[model samples]
Every structure is written in structure tokens, then in C-alpha cells.
Target: MNCYQKEDLIKMVEDAKQLTQKGKVADYIPALGEADPSTLAVAIYSGERECIYAGNIDEVFTLQSISKVLTLALALMDRGADYVFQRVGMEPTGDPFNSISKLESSVPSKPLNPMINAGALAVTDMLVGNTIEDKLERLLNFIRQLTGNDRITYNPVVAQSEFETADLNRSLCYFMRQHGIVESNVEQLINLYTKHCAIEMNCNDLAKLGFVIGNEGRDPNSDQNIIPLEIARIVKTFMVTCGMYNASGEFAIKVGIPAKSGVSGGILGSVPHGVGIGIYGPALDDKGNSIGGLRLLELIAKQSNLSIF
Candidate 1:
């Protein structure tokens, strides 16, 4: 396969940004709800090169559900996959991310997988640091290492807004607590989990962050292991199987790349040995994926022949 020229890729992003005009901006988190639905941006990066950003490229957005990937990988590294799996399954649930039917079923299972809310809470509980502050600090440090952006930090407004509006997630925690899947104090665990979701980032930062997975857990730019290779594979598999909420299957059939999306309107896509893409379009489809972001990825993968399949 041939590499894409940076300028060509940039034009593609510019072309794709037009998709934003057709989407509706996110409006649930209150803070996120206010994002201009028409806002769109894209960032692409590889081990040694970076290319084009259109529209709000520098605008900071919360990681939202995308934080699940980072915390799950770190939890796996800290506590091993076996222990983590015991609290969260590795299957896709073709249901809304916040579905309670599976949780209420007879098997009384762990969350269907780590990309969902229940699974992410379980993984957050597994982080090995001493205190909430310690755990968050470790997570932040880990994120900065992966993205090569040491100044990154959590956004308090987003955290507070999520905390205030997360009754469904709160209910999920309480349910897990009842089921013995989440051993941490329900309130504390949810707090830590939401704050991590509030970790702020932009398109460029997310693309660079995704490189850790695209390059098999190594920070290609720094030549260091941000995530162990084995852990990276597991995380990537989760991205393929459960990343786009209930749309994972469709995305696999269509775009065919490992990816994760956040309700805050960001998608992090992995194109191994080529590029990691970050797309932002606040509007969401019924499944909660970035409407424009999804279109942009499909177009790029088709044009650049980046599909893993």
C-alpha cells in the first residue's frame, strides 16, 4: 500500500467537514449540549507525520466514553486481563451502552465489555493507585505519555456537568454494586469514572493518542511503551467489537478499522502502520456516534485503502 500525501489528506478532512452541516450537535451533558452541532474538525497523525485539521481543531472537548480505552488498558497493565475480565466480559451487546436488560439477566453478568459504561466503571475500580487523586494523576500521566502532551488535564466544568446529569450511569453503578461486580464505593467509583470521562482533549491530541494503539502500544514518536503490546491488542479488539455503542458491527462492516467514540462528538480511529484519525462532529446518530465523524472515517478509509479487512 502507498502512503497518502499530507496535503491530500488535509483536503479530504476539509471536504468531510461539510458533513457537519448535516448533523445535530450534542446536547445532553448541558456543557456538551451547547456545542454547535455544525462544528466539525479532523486530525490525522502517524508515527512521524501529521496532517490537516478543519474547523475547531484546537477546541478542547471532553474524552467522554473514549476515556474507557485508556483506563481499561491501564487497568489491564496494572491488574492483568484475567482479573479485569472477571469484572467485565469481552462481548458486544447490540444494545444501547446504558442498557440494563443484560445487567438484570439471570447470568447477572459483568458489563458486556469494557467500552460500555458498566465495564468502564469496573475497569476504573481496578486501577492500582493509592487514592482517587493518585489514580487520576496516574491516569493523566499515562494519557500525556500516550499523546506526548504533558500539559493535558481534566476539565472541571465537564466533570461537574457529567456528574450532575449522569443519573443513568449512577443507576448502573448502583446496579453493579448490588450484583457485586463493582466492589468500590458506588459514589466514589462513579465520581472517579466521570472525572476521567471529563479529561479534556482536541482532535490532534486524540489522533496522536491513538498512535499508541496503532503502533502496537509503543509511542512511535518517543519509542517507548505507553501500553504493553498485549494489552494494546486487547484494547483494540474491544474497540472493534464494542467501540461505537451498538453500531460497532455496522462500523466494522463499513469502515473496518479499530475505533472508539465519545458522546462528546469525538471518534478515535486506528489505521495500523498508516494513521490514527481524530474526528469531531457534535451531532450524533441514533447510536450516539459522531454523525459527521463516521462519514469522514468511511470516506478516508475508502479513499486511502486503510481498512484492516
Candidate 2:
């Protein structure tokens, strides 16, 4: 496939940014509620070359649900998939990220994999450490290593907002505890989970970090095995199956790439041997994915034949 010229890519991004007007920034978090509705950017990292972007590429944004995929990989690296799966199932729920219906049901509702809020919360609870500080240190280290950025930090405003409005997540944690799925204190787990969801990253860092997955858990630049190949495979599978909240299936059909989206208006996509792409446009669809980001990804993947299937 021919590589797209830098100018062409820029134009595509400009065209894609127009999508932001049709969607709304996530208002659940007052911090995210203030993002420039028209802000849009795209970054593609391949081997040693970086596209380093357009529009709002430099704007710092929280990881939101995208942090789930990273934490899930860390948990798998620490506990292996078998143990992790026991705590969370591997299926898509066709439901909102914060939905409480499944938790309230009598049916044995294991989390449908570690990409959704429930599963990610469960996975975050499993990160091995005696204290929340240690866990946060370790998680931050993992994220920093993947993104190749040592300065990354969590956004306090976003974390505080999520903590304040996280009733559904708290309920989910409580439900996990009742089901014996959560091994840690419910409140503590929610605290760690919210902080993780609040970790801040821009498009360049997000794309490079996601490139680790496309590179099969190995950091292309560092040549370090950040995660076992098996663990990476499981994470990618979950990304494809349930990464975009309830719209994962439709995204897979249209974009045909393994990706994860966060309520912070970011999408992280991986195409084997092609690219690791990141897009940011805080306006969200009902499922919480950035509508413009999703559209750009679909166009790029369709044109580039990047689908894993």
C-alpha cells in the first residue's frame, strides 16, 4: 500500500474534524465538558517515524476508558489471562459502559472482558500491590514506558469529577464484591480505577503507547517485552470485541481494526504492520466514543485494508 502524503493526511484530518460539530463533549465530567468542541487531531506512529499532528494534537486529555486497555494488559502480565478471566468474562454487553442492569440481575454476570468500565474496574482491582500508592506508581510506570513520555500525569480535575459522579461504577464494584469477583476493597478499587481513567495523554503519546499492542506487546523502540504475547492477544481480542462501549460491533464492521475508545474523546487503534493511530475530538456518541475520531478511523482502515479479520 502506498503511504499517504503528509499533506493528504492533514487534509483528511481537517475533513474529519468537521465531525465534531455533530456530537457533544462528554458532560458527565465537568472538566471534559469544557473541551473545545471543534478540537480534533490525529497522530500515526510507524516504526521510527512519527506524524506528530494537527489541530489539537498537543492538547492534554485524560485517558478515560482507554486506560482500561492498558491496565488490563498490566493485570494479564501480572496475573495471567486465566486468573483475570475468572474475575471477568470475555464477551460484549451491548450496553452502556456504566449500566447497572447487568449487576442488579440474578444471572451470574461476570464482566464481559476487561475493556469496558466494569471489566476494567475489575482488572484495576487485580493489579498487585499492597497499597494504592504502590499500585499507582506501578501503573504510571507502565503507562510512561509505553508512551515514551516520562512527564505524563493524571488530571486531578477529571479524576475528581469521575469520583464525584461515579455512582454506577461504585455500584458495579459493590456488585463484584458480593459476587466474590473483586478481591480488593470496593472503595479502594474505585479510587484506583478512577485515577487510572483520569491519567492524561495527548494523541502522540496515546498512539505510541497503542503501538505496543500492534507490535505484539513489544515496544518497537525499546525492544522490551512490556507484556507477554498471549496477554497482548487477549487484550487485543477484548478491544475488538468490546472496546467502543456498545458500538464495538458496528465499529468493527466499519473500521475493521482492533481499537479502544475513551469518554475523554480519544480513540486508540492498531493495525498490524501498518500503524498505531490516535484521534481526539471530545464530542461523543451515546456510546462515549469520539464521533469524529471514529469516522476518521473508519475511513483510514477502509482505505488501507487494516482489518484483522
Best by lDDT: 1
lDDT of 2 by residue, 44-145 (tens): 887575654656688888989898998988888888878988878887888888876765662576776677677788889889898988999899999998
Q: C-alpha displacement of 1 in model 1, angstroms?
A: 10
Candidate 2, run of 10 with poorest lDDT: 1-10
lDDT of 1: 0.84
Clash statistics: count for each candidate: 3, 0
Superposed on all Cα atoms, model 1 deviates from the true structure by an RMSD in Å of 1.8
The TM-score leader among the candidates is 2
Per-residue error (Å), model 1, residue 33: 1.0
Model 1 residue 83 lDDT?
92
